[model samples]
Target chain A: MRAGDEEISVSSTSGSRPTSKDAVINLDHGDPTMYESFWKRMGHRGDITIAGWQGISYFSDVTNLCWFLEPEFDHEIRRLHRLVGNAVADGHFVVVGTGSTQLFQAALYALSPPDTPHPLSVVSAAPYYSSYPAVTDYLRSGLYRWAGDASAFKGNIYIELVCSPNNPDGSIREAVLKSENGTIIHDLAYYWPQYTPITHAEDHDIMLFTVSKTTGHAGSRLGWALVKDKEVAKRMIKFVELNSIGVSKDSQFRAAKILKAISDGYELPNPKNKYKLFDFGHLLMSVRWKRLREAVKVSGIFSLPEFQSSYCTFTGKRTETYPAFAWLKCEKEGVEDCENFLRSHKILSRNGKHFGAARKFVRISMLERDETFELFIERLSSLT
Target chain B: MRAGDEEISVSSTSGSRPTSKDAVINLDHGDPTMYESFWKRMGHRGDITIAGWQGISYFSDVTNLCWFLEPEFDHEIRRLHRLVGNAVADGHFVVVGTGSTQLFQAALYALSPPDTPHPLSVVSAAPYYSSYPAVTDYLRSGLYRWAGDASAFKGNIYIELVCSPNNPDGSIREAVLKSENGTIIHDLAYYWPQYTPITHAEDHDIMLFTVSKTTGHAGSRLGWALVKDKEVAKRMIKFVELNSIGVSKDSQFRAAKILKAISDGYELPNPKNKYKLFDFGHLLMSVRWKRLREAVKVSGIFSLPEFQSSYCTFTGKRTETYPAFAWLKCEKEGVEDCENFLRSHKILSRNGKHFGAARKFVRISMLERDETFELFIERLSSLT
Candidate 1:
């Protein structure tokens, strides 16, 4: 086994932290292990029991256009979105995918015109998610090609990806490059009340969200896309069909159960069974952010992006954004590569170059277990 | 709701078949609902219990190159393969996929040279898997393009797909095209004792297998690739990483449990435990095939492919093949399109044209539930 990965798994699962000099705190990727305790507290409420004979057929509900989607999952998804008031799922067609990663590619495939002479231009902001380019261009698909940052892209017809409360840096985003022929796909993966304020119900033409970021079920690899246009939604479904046949039904079952638990925590009549997921998420994130900010201040080596407080429609309170990642800028005179600087100290962070940003900025995950987070803060505090 | 789809679901679930003319017998898709009874027989032994907190992390075993693969799954996959003697798993890297569908595309990506000036040509023999051309050409990738009918292909360099105990017709196959620079990928999805004779253990450069065909867990959407070359395996893993980040860990967990149960049936010392999956599968398939052949003979309208008995190494007996599908041909003097003729009679089957064959041939699923299969036989028997 990867020794580093073993240490990370151990740190997340158990309360004990290794005192060895080589326990590298892996924050390079967003693993979402921080939510383990919340689910543990949930006990059997979070348990997903699947019978062997159930879900044996490939067909779930064939009456719907998105027939691959389980009815329970569809019901739970719509219920959760309506309860949170983040996005409208009432009139939209829901296409399930392996994950938002697959859905992103599906969105690209759906939006890109197949008969175009040249590949359709795909762009996002400079500090865009690293995967947009990597996933799009890896296959060198003739349907679409990456065209770098959206702000600098000059195109008449293009597919622009708008990741709101964007990755690397949590900033409210909109279509930077607009044209009548241009189409926009909103990656609302991090738009939940815990990550950002649910200011209003988003009414986008095409929106993508995932269970990985929402419920911290990264291993589930489940996601859905909401498309206003029927033709686009059908095309996305075709893409999923052509890509992986369909999403995993077991994951869908588990996701449905988890989502039902979350919704029931808020709306259930039983007073003794109260366990609000968002409240737990919000408080935990706030505490972690506070600790991280203080550690950064004490070290005097790095600076974090400041977020403004806004009134949340769901929580009915004013709160600052607590992004899943920390966009830390290395303020030191010669620290060009912040990722390297952090890696040197046994704290792994993603290089900004990967996100099409300057090397001075590095993205660190704020979602790790307390033991790992505490160790990270301890390591950062002594860096000066 | 799709009325036809709903009816099919009901037929698979309930024992009753609708007498209404509108209830279409959907043998068009291989839903694998026949195995539901086997899993039902398994009872709680087939149950998969997943804690909400467990498998939240993206990392499973980072120590391995195929980092996203769960350790339990890897172990169980090797154990099962060894138990069956279907393919050589030792000294090969195992890469997990959403399904064999995703793994097929990943195999294409791995075989193709990304820097090639022109798209790599992908070819397969006639009556190939219907999805071969559809999935390969859907996106029209510049990395590779579908070049049909490998037997007729004249090329200096190409990638050939070899699906043994082939899809439309159950014929054991080997690569028909060969060249110095050519690559071969084996789709051994149906190379099990139940579907065909286990003549020998398969040891190829690249081999693909799926839970859908093996254990009949179509809804799980889990598959694995055994690759001999390190670089090729790495590329395949990268394609999966880009395609969907990774396969569903919940599905992986369930697959592992199912596989463990399967192996335990054969090798476990407990005499009380006597459920052998292959033995169950072989007997069920044989009875279905026997009934289908008798019905076809009595009707004198349709003809199915004839098979030669072979000595099975696993069973240690001469056994006739029991294919999952029946490639039936219309023997009527005037009928050219068998699919259309079947559709008119409320029996849905896949048109042979989809598999790059003549219109007179139609592929019918033989693995439906007992009620559906009986109805199908009754309809076939009633035909003049």
Candidate 2:
């Protein structure tokens, strides 16, 4: 049950060298590893030292509409939003969650009427985040049911989870189904300057964001939602309270510290500081995306969807899609299952079928550590 | 919006003096404040300092059945179990959760079949934890429904949640329903030596524990369940994965540090260190209970349930009831609602009706800070 045991088992089963086709290298999980060097550069500045008695109270600030939120967390969230200039913070209530995952479920719960004649349909576009359906339908809640593909969905009283800078293909997206009955939850988890251009200060009715994708601190398990409607925010808070009482204050405290550090790095007066989290993150991701595209071009056996460059206010420059994941479509006629093809080459990938896409497509994580990504690129290059 | 604002509001609403009967002091929340001194004594030993890059991996150890767990958390859980000797850790799998609240839901999700003809009945004894029904029926999931009072429940296929040293009224309890179709979840949240006598090592099929009651770290929002069945544990893990992906690693890390400090204090060769967490907690709670009883004795308007002294293996001494909450019954004439009576004096206590008890009774949390609890006692004594 130790982490060492897992490493030993994987190494033993897959062999040490990359020459073995079946050697295991998990590139399927969307863990953000691009910030490792950036954080390492920041050193103890990003470290969180919590006192034993810190946040001992179950309730953080009782007056906060979202009472469970740590005050520091509330401040840091607003500060981060202000720095990013991606999401509007004013006149919005922030509901903290374990992650965007919990927030997604909470949003679904909040949007749907408890006594609806039929379960409200929850639809995201095809090639959506795989967990959307699983999370929505797991309990088979009477409140809501996963109704796939918003583009094709013809329904009233529905929840459309718009994951802009979408998961699988990293496409900049908008709501396809527009109706008063449709509640759009804009999951702006990847709308950070590192991933895509901040078109404008998004003022969606309900918007979701997570530190996991923003700073590659997935294990922190911190996310928040900005809701225009107080009632919706209250319902979302109630859902969290019933689900887990509240998000971890320890996590919230750490997130606040990390977020502050990120903001400080961004606001560093000296341009030569080299520890600008946003700049570091953007550079790292941009390089990774460039290297991946070049590798795909050299391989000639896989293709990626071309992304249009757009001006980003945060960086004040035009940027291309530097997604946390690379959705690859196998160009070879024989490779029906792109996942299996990648698996054969010692690369573990999430099949596009899980994302409600064709079997010819596979999602490879672009968030792996440098050494792992380099090896993946080498192995991918050999496939040609 | 801020903690300072909340403090100001409370002070503004109720003058800062204890002489006034209409001075507010919230004694409704069972936030264990006894451990604050103990943790403060431990100082940096109990403090958690997590590096920026620590726990960046979404998956900690794949070889571990609970993939989301930090190895240190697993180790700390076992160590704490060993130190307490109230719960058996051997031949069990540990599933970390957001809290015992989330774990409670997870256990129900794991126990109930997804394709059952009817939702599995979830039952708890009368005067149970109020959150049970609220959490279970929040979504009105097709998988389970809250069936009140296991004592009256006649159903065969059901999930019974047994909260030992039960909430509201502190009483040692077991499963009231003994059907083979029932799956029992032992919520040993307040089963620590400070609250109750740890007479024997509990070897339930599924047992729950939380730092909230154990270490007074409710804001940490961390809990662990020990399950004897691997399949059940796996299913519970799946539930957590769908619920919030996983518990917070930041909280897990902090819990591990705090638990380690607790264990260290117990295992210390030098008993003169005066930092033993359990001994400190027991002493504080014992003093509080004694003071409360004496105060109530003078007031003569309220009554507390008499608890028998029991031989505790942890302390190797007979211990009286030092429950986290005081279940008080108003003996005053024409006092139909004890909560309302207390609220009239600006002392906030949970109404007994919330716990499915008589309107004459109320639950006052003895776990508040010393100043607040003292103020509550002053208010109660004034009512006489």
Candidate 3:
């Protein structure tokens, strides 16, 4: 058990106050629940149906679900094949995964040598996905050094994880030369319809997607990576089967179900909308961008840049696509910690420093509903 | 990209046969969707709101639902703490997973030393989880050695994954003392109210629980391990966060919602079910046990000595409590390869060999709803 709670005190300048007494206007973390009133407006509530005794036999049920899913989604497979075929038009094979994060770890596992010493050179562009440095440090026992800038990224580096439409800064597709010296794994977590049209399908050796973002059900835990090389995909899939106990067969079915829902909508259209099927099957591109623009205007503490200036669009034109995240260069004065300032006030924004950026950039999620947006704006305004 | 498609032709066994033409009874796999009629009854048609967007975004209105998830449940830190606490009580702390399989690989990562010239040795009791060997082999690059018996388990051994209520044979808890040489991680996926009392609060150092079993909502992609050691839990949690880009925040909320549902039913009293709650709960348990017994009696392909010799005890019965899984020791005369035989017959039972067991055992799930159980019995009878 816990060896007698040794009172360990942690002090953070942004949030070191006694949490119990301190009323936190939390902007530091990305919990969607911060927008409670809005969730109630949508169909979500607090009522959960217990599988009851039915839950007792879920193990067997799960095994069976996997069996049913493999065949029923043959159309899905074909659809994925068609999607991959589009990727193959660029040349890639879609590697299905529990989440693209699994693929990220797998890529590291597959590429990194076991004997690699501490300070293995790992590099990424400034303001990339925050998790890149976090994951690398985590895997290497907090010993993995974050190699300098992408421009200066050289030497016998072990691996590099880069995210487009980057986590905190919302940087989209940038250029990269072949990293023959180090293995390069592109984490295109937001490369779906939200950030951009699914272009450059065959550009990278690895690309990842999940049901969470594409379907707006991040809880589904279904994500996959498209690997140009079959060997990598095979390794990644095998890695997944070993992790999280094969991504809950039930999860895959749900993903397939959700995907089926998307496809079904496409095949059987809603006449009221004047379309034969739901043109936007399971994706959330246009709506999110609108919300992002709205949030930026309301929350004055954030510094907004022109399109693509924040790694969003390649050009400044308002397009039909962009991811759900708006990376804001938070004005932290000389503190140089944008993520910290927001967290102190109870807003959970991601710190850009984790993504190799020197400045304090924070990633604000546009996933909240209207009331939440208002609350976030109010809270943000007060903070500034 | 996939190499020249023209050059890759499959043998007949591996070739894509027409679904209708290629059926040996598929008992080897565990899928409950085979009985879709029940799911429709359960109101699992599809999410009406999710039908709108075709992409997932941070600001997607998906979380704003009135279906019964509370806003408080979305706190990731608190929820993740609970998830970690649950895992620790089960005896292992390594969250090295996006899935349990990911943990399996993480165990290897933790256990396997880089300088060892020979492949690391992995050992488990017979009739283990099937994915063990498959995942282990996949990670070893065809070099890891599987020391078959518990007695021979020895040095240079990186890790050992053990499962209680041994998958195919239903051996409740292995005598772990005999196999304590290596870092022992237990896959207690089935250790729930079925085999273990909900009151069996005696926590272990590590264990695993997936929503698939606890709530029958496998699609949630939520699972956790209970690791007691703080250090290990920290590492595993880090591994998980890095691998899957942090578990689907949405899935975590849904799972917590379901968990509260399960806990609520047992903890509170409702007017609709005075004694009805207790009675209904027990009845559900009986239903599962009855189904397992009936399937065995009618099919006669497998023997379930545990069920035949089980008692209705509340606690400390030294018996497995997970009612959903029926680990069977296969005794059929010609069926040496349990996996192949079950697959050929269209009954998808997991082969026991992967679980470090003799090939005579297979893990069969008891999660089929009542009607499907009846149908499965008929299919089994036909096999006889």
Candidate 4:
């Protein structure tokens, strides 16, 4: 609830302390490049070779509703979900997408009634993912329109996008508006054990997961949506079909291999199984959070939200959340625009106004390279 | 143009095909699996491997507007276009997409004026590509709406989609709606040497090309648009960024390799280079069309459009167009619906009405595997 005022001594990492004063530090977007070192340590276990003739066909499995989805990709997705115990993939239809972003749009399209006299209202709580409003309105879709602030919304029939371990601000969330006619889409991109506790196996009407956040393969551009309803799943597939014919099988093939490697690190009966993706991610996130907290304490100008500890079934431990981003609030006198203040110091951060929050709040990515994070900490510590 | 009723004698191929009678021939979609054999012959030339830590970041080149586009892929694209003398890629911004389908939607978004009081009307000449209206209106976008048949459209301020070597019907076409205020997106997906004669280098304001049609990698789900206008290209890139963040780097990496292999077949100074993709495609298409014509002549029930020969700049030879899809019209009495007529005999074809054409005509994909095409020809030969 407040900035950590007490300084705690800790052993320094092998990486050199940041001293660069001229390098531009951009913590605007959650790029997730921090996981690159772990992956490099994992090495060729995740490497995949795709021949010219293999996966050349348009259809992967013609019998499935999502015919474009690679069978191996689907298998690995379900396997990963089962391994983590974060989401229930059993008896649910899996629809693969270009990314969670595309699947989000498809969810909105599927949930909205086509025969409605007006565009279906789409709402999320205040400080929602920055993209929710921008993406919803960018296309100017008549099928659905963004109705900001779900708790303030009065409509009964609306689509709610609940980003649990939410973006900009990391908080486990559910639909604030209570209505039977309302549809909810759970964006569980950050619900993995690394960022938050696997409190329960989520069995929502619709859930979206992305490799970008889970395995830090942002360039792979692969995501999947698990839908409980057959019709809604089919409609989402239809949207993808009409959008890109289907996803790239090359990504699917590579992603399947990458995910298989991750799952194998835990599931396989091996002596040295230390390359577990979640374990690596969790350790990195914890360290980053600790470093950020120390930097904030030294700066004496910013405050961070305190998260409650929860028991994680996957990790078999009670731990506080380690979000991919830091929602920092500028507490300095007359520092109303925290993002602008940071920009003046050669630090780029996303203004909280984009997420429908106060000008004093700014979202700083904690998923950048180690050197960049060190630079950010050094810059922050120098601010006061 | 009318169907050629004359008996065309063709030398029989070595393969003992046309024996499968119970097989269900689904030519409803252009799967483009026929190019598999060509790639197989090329073998290992198009293979690509990605390391666990490579391409982990979301950005490929932050300096470019299309930041997600791999510089290697862009270079290969320009190299291929120059080698083939198809589209003018120089001095143009290259925007990679999920497929040409995604780029088409992006074009629609870019071309449509967002502030217009009414949705910008989108029209293509009939019978246009079947998905034009479906994709344009599926989202019910307020930015643009599908206005059927470009030739019949009354509005001067509209967007025109001109598919050269047009889908369903293989006619080299230009925009029918010629207005100073009108925007045209030329879908040159089938304008390659194998599908059609490339008479001149295309220099359209917006041109879309896909590997699915050009290189027979439909599963790759990769395409690029060459845009003359900088602002228009930027808007299209924005649409893609919002739709999927960007195209998959896996696909881009593999597609670049595949395209490079194709170009290398001709460019590499080797005497025994026999794995030319276009040559293979052209030969197969010629044989398929010959067999199809012969089968139709024997069936005496279906008609096909007659095409004129043109000098190809790339091939340096005069040849009639070999379209990826056959526009087959039922000549039999009482057969008002050709798609339905074909469906009864276990042969699948897309209904012509979907393309704003007569129900008597259907579009049969010419890009399916050899076995399927052989079965289709046999089925057609036995239909009457």
Candidate 3 lDDT by residue in tens digits, B65-170: 2111223333332343343232323233323234345555544544444345676666676655555554554333322445555555555344565665456555
How many clashes in candidate 1? 4
A1-384 per-residue lDDT for model 3 (tens digits): 011111111113111122342334333333333223322322222222323222222132222212212433334644643442223313455455556666666666556554444545666766666555544543333224456466666565556666775655555545453545667777665554445544444367776655555545554446666567766655554455445534544344445555554444335654553221113321333554554566656765567544531222222333444545666786545658876676667666666655555446766766554445556555655554
Spell out the clash pairs found in candidate 1: A1-B63, A2-B63, A63-B1, A63-B2
Question: What tens-digit string does per-residue lDDT give for candidate 1 at A220-338?
Answer: 99999989999999889878877887789999999999999999999987576447888888898999999989999999989999999999999999988999999999998888999
Give each model a TM-score. 0.95, 0.94, 0.61, 0.95
User: What is each predicted model's overall lDDT from 0 to 1?
Assistant: 0.86, 0.83, 0.47, 0.86
Cα deviation at B235, candidate 2, in Å, is 0.4
| lDDT score for residue A336 of model 2 | 97
Q: How far off is residue A343 in model 4, in Å?
A: 0.4
Instruction: Assess candidate 1 and give its TM-score to the true structure.
Output: 0.95
lDDT of candidate 3? Answer: 0.47
DockQ for each of the predicted structures, in order? 0.55, 0.53, 0.16, 0.46
Poorest lDDT segment (10 consecutive residues) of candidate 4 chain B: B1-10
Per-residue lDDT for A366 in model 4? 85
lDDT of 4 by residue, B1-384 (tens): 011101110112111123457756778778788887887887788888888888878888766778889999999999999989999999899999999999999999999886777999999999999888878888878889988898888979999999999997999998887789999999999999998888999999999999999899988899999999999998898789889989999999999999999999999875875778888888899999999999999999998998999999998899778999999999999999998899799887788888889989999889888888988888899988
